[model samples]
Every structure is written in structure tokens, then in C-alpha cells.
Target: MRMALRALPLAFALAPLTAALTPIDALAQPNPAKMTFFITSAGLGNGADLGGLAGADQHCAMLAKAAGAGEHIWHAYLSTSATDGKPAVNARDRIGTGPWYNATGVMIAQSVAHLHDSTANTGKQTSLDEKGGMVNGRGDTPNTHDILTGSTPDGRAYPPGTDTTCNNWTSSGDGSARVGHHDRQGGGEFPTSWNAAHPSRGCSQDNLKASGGAALFYCFGIN
Candidate 1:
């Protein structure tokens, strides 16, 4: 993993603290999964209908299982417009409210959609040009891209630690800070660390390359 300059010193300080702890005690401790994470495009489509709530219950069940969620809830939503200025809304508006639920049929993640002209693709699973949106035309289409926020199953946000940027901050004309190629085909995990630092911007397709389409995920805290 590429260590950030600011995080390096903190990482070193924490190492010794960990060493002082008992191995068995640490090993036995359960690593709690946070409630927030970027849902895949496939997750959104499979989870909900355009405006109906019937499909979401089933979808959240599947999401909880796939994500190894413990007493946690998962959710999905649709976009009202296309990145290319096309009318995305159709008959699926009634099911806009999510079918949120827990492991035992208790509702957790709620469903909602935001309309924006973002160039970020909420589908696909590969790198692409900064301008290309989510990759649905290609193989393995995703359902939608969402900005992650809210409390965990137990209700907690991932702690802030590093700077996160999609496509290395290229989409909005931010200069490149990292060396990896932009994931144009979507289905990439939004950086939790970056989300903590730049919550106002949410997740964007700014730095992603334009040759291939990709989605953006952003993490944030529940109000």
C-alpha cells in the first residue's frame, strides 16, 4: 500500500501500541464492519425497482451476505438523469423509497436517488478516461454509484485518516497526486479515508480517465 506522508508517522506510533497488546486478546477481538460503504451498480438495480419497493428487501439480504455484514443493512438507488443529458427518469419513481432491512427483517439501509450531471460512471469494473461515465455497455454492468454515509448497523462512521480522490482528482481539473491509472469501467471502491476529509465534494469522477467509463463512491458520516 502507498503510504501517505501525513499518515506514515501516525502508523509508526500505533505499531508499538499494538505490540504491547496480547496476541490472543487481539485475535479474539471481532473487527466490526462499518455501516457505510459504496454500493455497486449491480447492487442498486438488483435491490430496488425504479419507484417500487418490492425488490429491495431481497436485494438488501443479498448485500448483507456479500459484504459479510453483521447485524448490518445494505441499500441501492437509481439516478434520475444520464451523464449525457438524457432523461433518466421513467416509470420507476414510486419505488424511490428503499426497502431497508436488517438480518432479521429489520430495515437498515434506505433507498434514494440524486439527479446530477456527473461524468462518473456508476457501473463497470475497470479503468477509463476521466470523462467517461460508468461502464454499462461493456461486460458486467453495475446498477448505480452512490455516495456512502450514515451510521453503521451499530451506527458509526469510518474514522478519517487520509486524502481520497477518484482518478487522482482529475475530473474537476485537480492535478494528479498519485500514479495509478483511472478506473474507467466503474465498480471501484470509494476511498473511505478521502471521504472523511472531503465530505463536501462527495464522490466525483474528476480525475478518472476519459477513455473508459467508471463510477465514483464517496464515504461520509451520518448527521
Candidate 2:
């Protein structure tokens, strides 16, 4: 049994390396192809003017395609207030029925109700980008923690009286857009609210940057 005894040592030596590469918990690692929810890695770069919901949805589809998850239809988690006699569009309705997971396979929420609940698992850790990378939070340099949502705490659009959507997400000049803190920790009236934290300072890129934002938002798969 000398040959068998000699091979045992090599097997033991390779075990740790394999384990390190493939992590003991497979569910905790990146699984882009199966991801259903993620924060946008980057914004449309035009501040809050996402070319309306159509352009924002297009961005989501483009990003999903690049992540290899294009089979599923994607939608930006954004809401629109009534403008030009059009009815408001709710963010919750756009994302479809829930139960979404991040790129790392971590469940962000079980349903639409759960997504707005305080216990949703969409904190700085689980609210990962499509690349399975964490977005900057409070203590990080430049602090890009703000995520544009334009909806209230319950994922519905605000009343048309005030400008909480950057003029229905078409202006980058003087209007403000409602933003949420993705990290769930910041200085806002609802600092811990993941979808309805505060309003942005302005719609331009520089104005958004002033309030610790980079024009980012969330995306969810509908199918």
C-alpha cells in the first residue's frame, strides 16, 4: 500500500487551495447569470435625466446583457409623477412581482411588500452591483451612497405638487429628484430607508455629487 500512502499527502495539500478558490459557501459567491437584482454599477452619467423611464429601462437591459443575464427582462426601479396629464408610474409596479436576488445570490427581498419593509436584506453588503461589487457608503471617499428612486417609502410616486422627480426625470437643470441611501445609513429624515430617504440637491451631475450621489439607481428582473 506504499503507492496509496504516497498519493494521500498530495490530495491533502491541494484541498485548501481548491477550497479557497471556490469558497465553502457557494451561495455567497458571485452568480451573475442567475442574478435578479442589483444596483447599477454606474449611472447614465447625465445626472437625474435618465431620458425618462424608457432610457433608464434600456440602461438596465444593457447592463444585464453585459452581465450575461440578458435572458430576463430588466426594469429600473424608478417612479414617475403625473405630468402632462399622464398618470404616475409606481416603482413597485415596474419591477414586477418580487423575490429578487443580488449577483451573489443573496435575497434582497421576498416580495414587493418585503422590499419596502425595514427588514429587507438590501443593505450595503447585499445591495451589490451587477458585478457583485459593493457601492461606496458613508465612510468611503467621495461617498456615493445616494440612489435615485423618485418614489415614496411605499414605492409610489409623490403627488404632482412638488418636484421630487427632476421634472419627471427629464431635467438636469433646476429640479430635484428623490433619492434613497443604498447603504441604509446617512443623514436624511429617513436615513435608513432604502427607497425613500431624501431629495437630491439638484439634477445636474455636479449638484448630485454635492449630496454624495453619482446618479446611480437599482435594477430588478421581471422574468
Q: Kindly list the per-residue Cα lDDT of model 1 for residues 44-143, writing each as its tens digit.
A: 3211121222233344435445545524443332212222343322212422344322222222234423211123222223211111123233233332
Off by over 4 Å in 2: 1-25
Candidate 2 per-residue lDDT, tens place, 84-130, comes to 88999999999988789999888888999999888899889889898
Models 1 onward score TM values of 0.24, 0.90
**lDDT on C-alpha atoms for all candidate structures:** 0.28, 0.91
Q: Worst 10-residue stretch by lDDT in candidate 2?
A: 21-30
Top-scoring candidate (lDDT): 2
Model 2 residue 65 distance off true place after TM-score fit, in angstroms? 0.4
Q: What is the lDDT of residue 190 in candidate 1?
A: 27
In model 1, the runs with Cα more than 4 Å from the true position are: 1-33, 41-60, 81-223
